[model samples]
Target: MKRKTIIVLVAAVAVALTLVAFYANSGIQSPKQEEKFRIAKVVRRDLGASVQATGIVKAMVGAEVKVGARTPGKVVNLPINVGDRVEQGQVIATIEQDDLIARVRLQEAILAEVKAEHSRLAKDFERDKQLHETKSISVQRYDLTEALHEIARARVLKAQAELDVAKAQLSYATVVAPIKGTVASVNTVQGETVTTGLTAPTFIKIIDLDRLEVLAYVDENDVGNVKVGQEASFTVAAHPSTDFKGRITSIYPSATIQDNVVYYLTSVSVDNREGKLMPDMTANVSIFLDRRKGVLTVPNQTVQREGSKKYVYVLHNETSEKRYVSTGWKDSSYTEILDGLKDGETVTIGDPGRK
Candidate 1:
């Protein structure tokens, strides 16, 4: 009976030790309290921070031309069409010059007739002046001839000036390109009479293709971050595959506030020499301000606050170790490890089995 009791006790002790070893190996301390930590791997990507904004592409040198005749006339001819390339002095359209020519001729004829009359009157007036002094002519007759001569001379001068102006108006009737650019559009066709009454008619629009600008409307909250000379990259929907890169050229000081929201117009410089980017193309812009390269970094999730100090867990030889670290500029993913860390260090983070 004694031997049997001792055997039973030893068997019971062995069973208890086996249960304890299994429990320790399974990593189940308690069932009530379970926790999990998200983990991330430190990566190397060009960190870019930007205030995103929707913008439109605009031509650097764009002009709408009001090239109709300064004086109203019928459209005689339009040599250029939409999309036609024109030189600076090349004629694009012609207006009816017949009326101007007729008026100029009439004025010139009138000037000639008045000048002939003035010459004869001047000779007679000079004789009249001499005769009046010599008592050969009456004072009233001499004064009257002298006044007629002066009035005829003034009329001749006025007619000559009118003739010159009429000829000049005829020259202005031929509309010409003021800039070297592609004609965006032609408003009126040949034989279409555009009324030049009061306001001048816009005949064509010319846009220079070498240079371009990106007009971005930045929200009031992000406007403070926008500054001149910030590097930026953008892509337009028209050419979605191509990236248009530029620098912030300007920030409008005045804010456009409406409906309790405010925004400012920001302009950036772009190159469109390839002519792929047209005016009014929508742009997706990203402004890059700061970056870090090849520096010691940790997953931002590992950063925990212990009282007032920042801490990160380090794994060394099957033991969990925590170290205090200093951090610097951080993005949404990684925090810059400024101090208290080095490259290639293993950090313990995340759940081993929880969830």
Candidate 2:
């Protein structure tokens, strides 16, 4: 009886262990039976092909202005600094015009006194002339009075001309902006002596940020295709990864060679109304001149090659539908489908192994 009981116990244990193993194995999923992955089929309606080149962003109208005194003087005030916006004819700085104004006042006073003296002398000379002619006054007296009158008249004219000069000098004390732009640099500050009589010493640089352009260099091979008015797009290092649209407004007739490669200079118009872009920014330009439009497309990862045959698995009825496909134009993120794909069909981009 004991031996029979042991045999029964062993049999029951073995049966229970087998049942647990069967349930665990049933829960496991097979590779071929895994759930299908979903992907998008974005239709490429119109896509442009471009030739890319590295270039720089430049302002269309940039200027370096020297807010200096036409007459040498101490700078009383410099209202603007680097990165300040200014308008045309705005007074940017001021010089001490006190000396010039004082000189003008002195000249004016001297001019008034000289005119009076000349008038009195003129009367005296006329009277002397009449007296000399009648033998009442000597010729020497009349000649001396005439000489004094002429000197007074000449002095009056000289003082008036000097007054005009002083007025002109006074006007030069105020430094004004010549263009409407943002102040790019400030070389000198308040109380600094900046002389402008000899040469244009730059005190500040102003650039019209609203009017911006990109200088692109196209390679010799692609230069032939690049033409004025061609559409272009680019991104600056200042605003990296953000795209900006522009057009090829100009193309140089000449070619430049560097490191044994020839390239043509091209200019593009950029709109920087937001003022986010600055001068001398390196731009990554894409001169797009050609495009292709609307057709079936698939994710680049969806299409796989097997022994020179491209195959894609699409999803339908919750199952993977395997099919051969052909591809066309592709970019960094998308691939164009030429054949073996239909609209609204969900394609698989990866193996459906995980939940």
- What total of clashing residue pairs does each candidate reach? 0, 1
Ten-residue stretch with the least lDDT total in model 1: 30-39
User: lDDT values of the candidates?
Assistant: 0.75, 0.78
TM-scores of the candidates are 0.63, 0.57
Residue 342 of candidate 2: its Cα lDDT? 77
The true-versus-predicted C-alpha distance at residue 265 of model 2, in Å, is: 1.8
lDDT of 2 by residue, 131-246 (tens): 98899987889889999999999998898899899888888788788888888878877888777655757677777788888989886656776878888889987788789989
Which one wins on TM-score? Answer: 1
Q: Relative to the unseen true structure, what is the C-alpha lDDT of residue 174 in candidate 2, on a scale of 0 to 100?
A: 82
Whose lDDT is greatest here? Answer: 2
Candidate 1 clashing pairs, residues 3+ apart or interchain: none
* TM-score for predicted model 1 compared with the true structure: 0.63
